[model samples]
Target: MQPGIIRLSGLFFLLIGSALVLSSFGRVDNAEKDFSPEQPCEWVFKISDKSLALFQDKLLDLAFETASSIPMNPHIKDRSRAQETVVLACLHLDCPKRALRYMDQIVDWRRGSCYADLAFYFARRDCIDDARRCIQIASQISESAEDWRRDRIRVKIAQTYVWLGQNQQVDEFEAGVVDSELGKVARVKAMRSDADAFHEQMQVLETRMESGNFDIMNNTLQAYTELFHRFYSDVQKRSLVEEKIKTAWNGMPISTRIERLTDLAEFALEHSDSDKALALVNDAQSLIDGRQWPLEHFIPMMGKLAALRFRTGDRQKARSEADAARVLFHAQKDTIVNIWKAGTLRPLAQAYQTMEDPDAALSLYKQALAAGIENPNSRPRAEDLTATCLSMALYAVEPDDDLWGQAHRIYQGLDHPW
Candidate 1:
């Protein structure tokens, strides 16, 4: 998966759902005293509206230019998915025309899904004609797709229709689905339609897994995570979601649970629930202290956990965690494969920045940029560099003159799609 896209996906969901819920509490500006730049909405809100628009334009331009550079090949699909992420982001930012330029650059089922998402975007704004037009185009693309790809696209179309409250259209696409992957697609369609049914099925699945039935599918757990957050405000629903997630992770490796807990902590922080975020971070820390993991997993998790701890107001421990991660990074720097060096360093840099160590952060950022350039695979190399640039831009990390020149030189030389 593209790290660049992973970072952007959270923003896409926040723009569509969380922003509205948060507005009822008050604009992000009102909560400035309570939050730091660690919050995504707050960070973007800190920027002037004019600057935000200019940043959006620059991001889309980068995405489009990257997409244009990709050569048509079997592997091009993976590269183009990063551009697809930017298209969704552009639509959320009210840059629909720019989004369309990158839409056609995506391949197969993904392109159809992008149009379906665009249709949803338009539908929410009451642009019914444009919504329907995009849905028709998405449906046509789905029809031309073969086998499992067709069902995948249809699932996106059906979900979009659900959002549009077009039940007839939803059912039409649902009926056309052919079972694949042991009817997982059918289960996804059913689960999406009924929350109560999803809850009941999750209970049953959790029971079976605890009793030594085979592991739950990763996608099933992912679907649960996505759906459960919508009901996070409901006390009983929140309990159920927490139980399911913990149970699902029970038998996985400790590192996996640590990672998930850290992610849950970050998600809680996004919603401004500091108490819950701190609890999740404590749980992850317990796991971290219980065993020794390979440096690969341990270092990144420490970097992330450190930033989260700082956000939760545990400044002393956060500083210690960051220092420990920095130490481990130096010790293991030569042993880490070139492709993953930037991935590891980026988070460490963020942790330092969060801790108000700009000099250290700046040094690490430069090291990450250099490491990103070491990857032989052009596409992934570009992705690593793009992810670093995105983290700097979105989090308000200011580069000094020397680092700015270095980044500009690297970006100008990038010719492959990220």
Candidate 2:
């Protein structure tokens, strides 16, 4: 062959070899040529389930390893399905950290489908800025979203605002979405209308208060109290709601008194607010005395006082008040009262445990469990109390033993879908 021709032949061969090598390594010169748009959603859904299960088991390290082995950018259909699975899996695992990381990828392909889930995860993690950004993006796509899914996303956004303490946002969202006939009718129908709408309204107001919307707090409380009164028709329960609303209104400027009082009482018993909680409890007691509130009507307040006393290092007073509440609970023979009684035991047990009375705490926990079981409607409370009691007892005795196994079994037996 001629010298120039031989050189050209050699260059062509080398180029061909390079092309062959690249093909074997899954590389392509043309991006669209390599893309497979026909990929199905099922393939992505399976991978998502596996990933979510691993995450739930706290096997993130393993999940990462598996994800690393998969192709980086699959076909859009496959990618969209995979993103849905991954988003749901992250939610199930309560791992918002992972969800946030993968969210961009999901949104780049499928926007509206994952917004509600992403919003919920972000809200739960208290990632306000990111959540708002996600909401804005989701809102744009929401017009094209499914009706049920859009409603769900709106609710999630409203809840996120609630957690962020954005009272105005909550009100705006609720008034625009939730307070509509559709919203009220849907939730009311969901709860079967047997229960008062006040609980749901209170939840909204509490969310607003939590978001720091104090301006509307009193009005919300009044509205809530009226709703409670209209539903209960029981003079005592109405009076109780009225009293609580009054206290909430009175304490408005002084630090969202209801929230502060509850927090102080809880803090006094749990962490660093012992003295402050005691003082507040004293004030509450004085107020109760001044009003001559009926014992049945004032049990919850007394329970708070006892908790505050226990936190303030007043063991005797705490125990006395707890015992009094317990007696009143039993005497009333009211299922609602029994539920409160069961709730009271939780604090009493904590107090006893704090005073180094493990035996007493354990006993009270057991009693609480029994009380909870007696009222079938109180199964959730019973289950929780039983779990705590078992866990605590196990820690107090032998951590290595399978004490939690029994509690886990009981928890599994319950009908709670979560």
Candidate 3:
């Protein structure tokens, strides 16, 4: 209300808290919706908090009631389920800050269980210190530390920081280089050393990939992709990376080899080096066929291959490969597949659209949107979901369904940090 108000943002919170609920509810014209898991929670996944504000008070009441009823539990699963109810409800109320308040009162869900969630919300609100605090708490806690999902979240968070650090390093280095004549001389020497440094980094990444930790390999590959671009600061440095990448792939495990090749193939495709991309894709195929990768991995690799074939005017083979990928994906249990289910469909749909098959493309887009809607943790791939959802929303202008609303929810998720 007043300038220079104290209370560590209490007044500010009150104003924001009140306005968002009013603004959100007022903007929407939906009838009173039922508040339950099957409908309400799924609604949270489909609609933005701004659109859910009409149920704000009801959601907070249910959230508090749910958390209070569970008090404590010996089983982490039960406690987790209870906390999830509160979190989901708070999300709908447009009060993630309030969500953390309830999360803190639980007093039994361990520590890190809520830290990651809190860090994400606080980061979105631009409360850097609070987000950093949650990250510290998350790292220090051991509860559910062994869960693969938690580890994946940690790796993702760590990568964000590393990315920012790398960008800062590059900016500083470039600024120093441009500051003086001596800096120009230093850049010449630094470029030579960077080539050697790039090779060394690739070796480390190769070793990590060979260690057989798929998650680690994924993260390392992400970093390698960024660092390779950065280290190759000159034409000479850029030319040096390709040979080292080739050497590193030599005799590596088939999975690692395929990963390297897939990366290079994608890079070449983006750079319009069609021959290089096709050659690498060919090399990756034999390895892919030899290994039994999950649908999550296999579908993307196959889809990329099909797209390359499509580009080369091999329409027959492209359609065949796309059909094979769809069949294999349909066979996968939902518990094992995630966003990749929808992700692979988008590109295939694009290819169909390019081939003058709008009906086929629309069907695939619908399939992709459904897959995204079904996946509970679809926010990790909010980008892809939003793209596919946009296509679906545009294609289906039916009054009975709300594809546009679904697309809006995904776009909101994209606005938040993963």
Top candidate (TM-score)? 1
Which has the higher TM-score value, candidate number 1 or candidate number 2? 1
| lDDT against the true structure, each candidate | 0.60, 0.43, 0.46
Question: What does the lDDT read for residue 227 in candidate 2?
Answer: 41
Model 2: per-residue Cα lDDT over 1-418, one tens digit each: 1111111122222221111111122332232132112331111111122233321233233222222223333333333333444444444444455554554444332445355456645654556666676666566554444444455456555555655666676555455442221232122222122356545655565554443345455335534433442444444644455455555565464323433344334433433546645775675565566554444345545654575577687778878877777677567645454434444454445555555666766676565545544434323332333334322432232211242343333333444221
Rank the candidate models, highest lDDT first. 1, 3, 2
lDDT per residue as tens, model 3, 1-418: 1111111122122221111111111211111111111221111211123433333343344324433442132223333344444453354335555555555554432335455555545544455666567666655542334444344335324422332334453333233221111112121122233445665665665665575454444444444544444453354554555555555444546766665666556555555566766777777787788667776657756765676666555678777888787677677637444445666565566556555566776677667656665544323333344334322322222211354455445444432222
**Model 3, TM vs. native:** 0.42
What's the lDDT for candidate 1?
0.60
Best by lDDT: 1
Q: Tell me the RMSD of model 1 versus the true structure.
A: 11.7
**Positional deviation of 394 in candidate 2, in angstroms?**
15
Q: Ranking by TM-score, best first? A: 1, 3, 2
